[model samples]
Target: MEVSYREEGVASAASSVAGRLVADGVPARLAGGDPTLWGEDAEAEAAVRLGWLTLPRSSRELLPALGELAARTRAAGLTNVVLAGMGGSSLAAEIICATGDVPLTVLDTTDPGQVRRALTDRLESTVVVVASKSGSTVETDCHLRIYQRLFADAGLDPAGRVVVVTDPGSPLEQLAADGGHELVLAPPDVGGRYSALSAFGLVPAALAGADVAGLLDEAAEVLPLLSLDTGNPGLDLGAALGGAALAGRDKLLLEDQLSPIFGLPDWIEQLVAESTGKQGRGILPVVGADPNRSGDELVVAIESDVGDVRVDGPLGAQFLVWEYATAVAGLLLEVDPFDQPQVAESKENTTALLALPDLPTGAPAFTDGPVEVYGAATAKDLPGLFAELLHAIPGDGYLAIMAYLDRLAAFDAPVPEGADFEQMTDAWMMADPLTLRTLLALRTDRPVTFGWGPRFLHSTGQYHKGGPQNGVFLQITGVVTEDVAVPGRPYSLGRLQLAQALGDLAALETRGRPAVRLHLTDRAAGVARLLAAAQEA
Candidate 1:
């Protein structure tokens, strides 16, 4: 049961890297040795090296793919872009779309209804980009099926309308070739989550109309700047943080506005968790824009101002810098900086859920009078529409509950349900416990609605961050007042700061989880500005 480096040669190499860091005044430590925990094997070491080495070359090559994607998207007369993938495959794209004012939708959820709705409703003619490193991920496969169904329904050629990005030899590559779909290849050496600079990120960036070439160029330029021996920021930062972790500090915190960068945090989590967690002891890496220290030891903040600014794009740069720094920091701690065990558990849970039978359906009838629409000018004077369905025949309760439960469950499951057929009334009631009173207030078949701000912020935000890592967050912010003038003194500034703090906390709470934000200026405007901004930069 002794915890020590299993391979003398690998240990020696790691020690060499640690020695270089120490010589340059950076702290460095080692992690491994537990017979029970899976330590670094030869493959892990090679993967780490390959991850680092491919950065420069991948950046150079990804530029052309991005340019071509942009050209193709424009040529197809498409305005909206939909990215379908899960885990590392989709996180980077989600991050980029969230940062800019790009009209893009990302389907990271495995929930069947959510995916079906995205494809049938919002993504009808939109160009769909499917990204997966292994090409065999269940969630990605499910999404591809939905796309195919939607394409068939619309009478469109699925192959011509779809694009696939993956490793050259992956099953997805073969599928793309067989289907005659446009294909983008990730470097053979690059892992999925780490392939942000590869085709995984570049295609999405192109769809968002971002300067993908600039992003890659910026990343490539930083490769030479990272050195294990020199006091290079990347190396030194990694060493200091990793060393601190080995010295009994387990938590790493990232602070930034664009939350999507937490995708990199997810990437870091896998890196640190799998690499260090091998031995009897390991560091717990948590990614958040707002650091909430419950009992965490090491707190490393990527100074928002420093590093390569031009290359990172608005939000992408911030994430790239943080991701690079995190890797370097792990090196300083002398831990193998890549590996993830929790992923297997996630997949296992998803598979189990997918095999379960669909829930029953039943909808309760609404009996209450008209709903009091607050902020509405007409109010009670408007048509007395039944806000709740209390008198109508109850819809299939089992199906509705099943659907609702499926949505909530997928927040925690790796493979989500494809369809939710539960009664809408019963499903709404089950989804939110607080909605009981609201449900009692409505009548007829009208949808039971919840207040946007106060209720969602107070009730859902808790589970969004504090609950199990399975919840998905959708933050809706409306600018109805047009920068409403606030009294200067203590209240205005205090409220603004508080609002920012809460937003930051929400962002942090859902870090590495499924989340999206819709910021709209006017409530009257039909279109709510929706983007997957949760993990942007």
Candidate 2:
């Protein structure tokens, strides 16, 4: 792995941090799994979470089992591998599969339409891999219940088609064992985000035909350098990241277009944001973001030459290095990288909202075409509502668009029979939330970030609630045309999704952040109007 700090300020700051770390014997202590780095309160969590430090070597034991599972499923004609997970459980595997060009369907959202699509799409030949660090993850639980029901409805034994990956003693483990399903026990000490090298990440990726062994090997090669004071890619990158943030460059603009690994920034975004975002201070990662747009931003490119700092390596090494770097950054940021305290706020709020008589959308401030604009704004149209939202941005703050709708909402149109994968993907993006995000970005000089709902709830939702308070939020939610029921739960998937959005909106408002909610009464028309309004804005 190679990490270069080019700018004079960043280089000097990083060099100083490296020297201090060396004097303090940080590299050796960290390599040895010492847990006192983040101070007294975080020591216990740090001790348990440091399992990731050894994953590069220790995770090799699971390769044979993972390979066997893949082969067994393939032999049984289960060619469609669908992963039901969220945040760390899904992001790592998603990136790994995408990088390897493997076909792994990720069910990381609670959107009713999305869930229904996964349920009906090639169900006969599908194997569902349910992953969660803790067995009680609501989203994963919903996925398990729905998939099991679908499998049973199709006369296929859910036990034979379902695979579980979780901590040994988690509730899901017992359920999987009781149901006679294959279960892979993850290290109890490893946290979800840090489990990229653990069973949680490898299971789905390996099943989808990614080179799990090669990933571990790549990570292992870079492991030795992490213990060195100088010439250590992890330490250098961490120092640069932490130092830059401390020097008022708290907004991290990540560029990964030139990296061999695809979708790396999304994984890194979750890692860095959730790891450091707490106590009202943290780094906010903007993926595929532009440069020189703001003074408080630092550009870090992974295996890309066009950035203030460039970190280059194989995909496996990249994961391990970034994990190490985030830990080092936590020390500099004076926060525990292992714990996401504020991540539960939205979850708790969602639960509360679900228990209410109805999904409390509270009242729309006004109607804007097919969009129901909510929050404290008098705007009665899309453009006016958008203008008000933009005007809410603070001088050094950013704009975050949280979409509670299906990420595939724009891909409802059928593609031509002969359309290639890339072309189909392009067409999808053109009509997706990304198009609206691009238009909004052009309207603002400040950083603009877009995140898919419940998915980001597990990712950047931490930063949105616990990080800097200067953020202005624009939340978009759509009406569910075909709501899917959660077997044992009273609320449907659409209700759960809406509750999540409302819960997160409440969380942001409780933090005194400016937020606006645009509810889509008609998904297609609302999206078109939003896109057109943003273009005009």
lDDT by candidate, in order shown = 0.44, 0.89
Worst 10 residues of 1 by lDDT: 396-405
| Residue-by-residue lDDT tens digits, candidate 2, 229-265 | 9888989999998988888889999998877789999
Q: Please give each candidate's TM-score.
A: 0.57, 0.97
Off by over 4 Å in 1: 1-40, 43-49, 122-124, 258-281, 287-295, 304-335, 349-537
Q: Give RMSD to native, each candidate.
A: 17.4, 1.7
**Which lDDT tens digits does candidate 1 get at residues 224-321?**
54433443444444444555555444444433443334344444443444444432335544443233333333444333432111112234443344
At residue 327, give the lDDT of candidate 2.
91
Give model 2's TM-score versus the native structure.
0.97
